[model samples]
Target chain A: MDDLWYSEYHTPHVRFSVKVSRQLHYEESKYQKISVFESPEFGRFLTLDGIMMLTERDEFIYHEVITHTAMAVNPEIKNILVIGAGDGGVVRELGKYQGIESIDVVEIDERVVEVCKEFLPQTSCGFEDERVHLHYQDGLKFVRHTDNLYDLIIVDSTDPFGPGEVLFTKEFYGNCYRALTEQGVLINQHESPFYEEDAKAMKSAHRRISHAFPMSFVYQAHIPTYPSGHWLFGFASKSLHPQRDLKADAWNALEIKTKYYNTELHQGAFGLPNYVKEMLKDE
Target chain B: MDDLWYSEYHTPHVRFSVKVSRQLHYEESKYQKISVFESPEFGRFLTLDGIMMLTERDEFIYHEVITHTAMAVNPEIKNILVIGAGDGGVVRELGKYQGIESIDVVEIDERVVEVCKEFLPQTSCGFEDERVHLHYQDGLKFVRHTDNLYDLIIVDSTDPFGPGEVLFTKEFYGNCYRALTEQGVLINQHESPFYEEDAKAMKSAHRRISHAFPMSFVYQAHIPTYPSGHWLFGFASKSLHPQRDLKADAWNALEIKTKYYNTELHQGAFGLPNYVKEMLKDE
Candidate 1:
């Protein structure tokens, strides 16, 4: 990897990118980079974008917040399918539940998974977990084939304009609806609400998801290294509203060492501002 | 004023400025840079180390969470003084209560006030209000002149290295105690908790404030544009423990347009990660 640039977003977290690995196995894309570093406290890091998407210590926050929030609301969540989680962070988090029978991860880039297994072992822990299974295939193709099976589906994809763009479209959302059971829940990593276009894209995605699912909503979290230091996640469920009134003690019993996503934060995360609420309504 | 850099914390709300004014009207400082820009939707933007710190659109989340949490616990609150609040966002928020009698804003840079008034009028509204009296002077000197007077004194200074360094010292905390009435509350804007040195400085300041006052504590807020998205504020009071069982109606009645600060958020902001809470206990 070569030709890298680092921009100081906020203090410790610097967003940087290097060239695609010379041994890169994936098809060429407009912009793709391979970079790795280690933080003093967060351990090893690997990001698809120049942006530091997650620290090794805090990756659970994004994965758990998306997975568990839906799982808690949809108590019958047994079969889970994760889309584009090449890092395996989502699958790792999903494997925590005792009730979850099987978890399948569909990733387009086998190289990302291979790299994670070799370098980012912490994130790749899901691959080794007995309950988890990996499928090196396009998420869209996998979701289209499945029918009324998965109780929870998580789309942990990259930015919308990249290979992940198809996942944000109406067609993919329709397939997700078809792939889910009546009580199933789907969560996606939406773009930031700070920029107009990102917000618009998220709102559009939310509208499409709402059309397919009974309930859909957006929530926010502070990812310091991300653009504008804030990011939003979109959630859609067939029957559940995604708001769980349970205490942290109920979930803290699992004893996950998460830097951010606590039970108290789970509820508080959904408390949107009037502006965000208005935007959702406008959608 | 010449060679100025104005940082808009919120897109259209608050902006903090560092201006090298030709004439030194109030005091003989090398340059005059004011702290706290409390414009309309832009809550409070503080300038430190020639850099501007802006929170999300929700300024009250940081300001109210810092000020009110301490103030609410201290039942006997009357006179208050805010240091370096050129934007008057804190003062405006403080003005909401009938318990607060007179509020004195001690700002060193009149140019900042003028700029805020001209550019960000909503923050300047604090000055126009009858309860707030403007004192264009040094905060350190002003604190030195009094003993057990103010019920609450908010050190809304910039970063610790610049004009704000004095505000973060033991002497300044001692002066604050001297200026405060018995059972008085004091809250100061500390720097990013992510930076060890800044956290150490804040912890030291907390220790000093604890020595001067009976109780001292630190809390965090998510300010997107700050060095770290997560920033900490130190709170100290002679008698109060800084916890309030807030009624829903009371919390809801605060007529501030906030994107983040709510009653639940007010409590949640104090809930720190174990690492941050552990850092506060260091020697």
Candidate 2:
């Protein structure tokens, strides 16, 4: 297929469809759409849920910032769980650390795994590694049975609608809290801070997560495909602040190519604006 | 009026219309279309040549970072020039200093000034100040007749199209270099770094600006209305780098109710990722 069609929620009733020269297929069982497009810079483009989610050029930034921030903070991160990471981008980032022995990825769509293996080979490299275990099931359902078994859990789902809507609720966060070890950490992708409604919803979700966990914070990144270009990620941990002192050797050991995330950016990302800091206060 | 209509250029051929609430009619004279709308949380919105541009919330972030960075570097600044700031937002930020003696505003469209005065009252507040001198002419033409005089020259034009296209060219930047004092500064609003095409264009523009000026750098801000949520501003100075020792008392003394610009942010704005720093390395 030369043409791919998809829709994004711009507002409450505003949905826009964009067409691009690519091949896209939807999996009924997973209710997820996987797309593949040829690009010069990143090699191949992978998108989910009708959005151009990640490209070959800068996937490391999103994956590393989300995973390492929590993992580095809690030193004893052995067993981890990644919820809804069908592309295996997070798993690829998580696999970099020798300390992480096993990682379980709960993806609603099995076709996403198949498509990633075929089209986005670079991101699918994690599946070949012995450390990662793939589980084809609902993330919310998987977490209920697995309690106090994980050191870190990352909710790498799409927008808070359809299959991901329950991921943003307090009940799911409570389940995630119970599924973690005493010093575990949880990170979820929050929407744009530019949209007042979305920001408020994300803030409310963060509040619920904070009530369940001891420490919670929000950080942002500039993602072109998302609405408002700026996207937020909420971090919650049982005992530690997200900011961890980077060992000189470990900081120098990162080998992945990234356009947005770096040792400097890792520090700057946690430094929030006074307004955003104020918004997250007393939560 | 309850319903207001305006268009935005996502791509060269892709134009989207935004329906707002209020509109100030500008008599058709020089430009194709000019109007101002009172948007929610976006502040005073300006539409020119059928393109919706400039929202209030983050406008100061762009203007302040561009102006203050250059101004802080220079020990002595007497005269300044602003090109295409129809709403006088940059001028408002410029007028914050008691040291600035005079400001000349060269705007091509008189309709934007009138619309801003009538509808976007807050943005037009700087025009009413006695220190500001408004001139109705093209910035390119205005700069050619001027000699080396201004301490600071800010090119606050829109994207590189329509009447604002010349502002992005090498010839215009050469003219600006000639129009500035021996130890002057020049700043322009470049496109976002998120989009590779726009980022390349901005890097090209930076290369041209570097040829005329001794030092050149690029910084970014998060503006939602723009194509990418992240926007870049290029800075060129003759004698000084854009870093300055900000006096907390002096900055706080300027009693401006700013939504974004602050002392800590001023320093933080220059902190770029390894990728951004790498992009500007050879340029």
If you score just chain A, what TM-score does every candidate get?
A: 0.84, 0.85
Q: How many backbone clashes does candidate 2 have?
A: 0
lDDT of 2 by residue, B202-279 (tens): 777878898878878776767767765677888787765665544545656656455555555555566676667777
Q: Find the candidate with the highest TM-score and give its number.
A: 2
For candidate 1, list the clashing residue pairs, or say none.
Answer: B13-B42, B14-B42
- Which interface RMSD values do the candidates have, in the order shown? 8.4, 4.0
C-alpha RMSD by candidate, in order? 6.3, 4.1
Residue B174 of candidate 2: its Cα lDDT? 90
* Global CA lDDT computed for model 2: 0.72
Instruction: Output the TM-score of candidate 2.
Output: 0.83
Q: Give a tens-digit lDDT track for model 2, residues A231-258.
A: 7788887776765643324644656455
- Write model 1 residue lDDT over A1-283, tens digit each, in one string: 3532333322122222222223222232333565566544345666665545555755755776777777656545789888988888887777777878988888888777777788777778878889888888888888888754888889998877677788988889999988888877788998776546667877888888888887887877766555555678988877677565343465676675655566656675776645566788887
Indicate the docking level reached by candidate 1.
acceptable
Model 2: colliding residue pairs? none
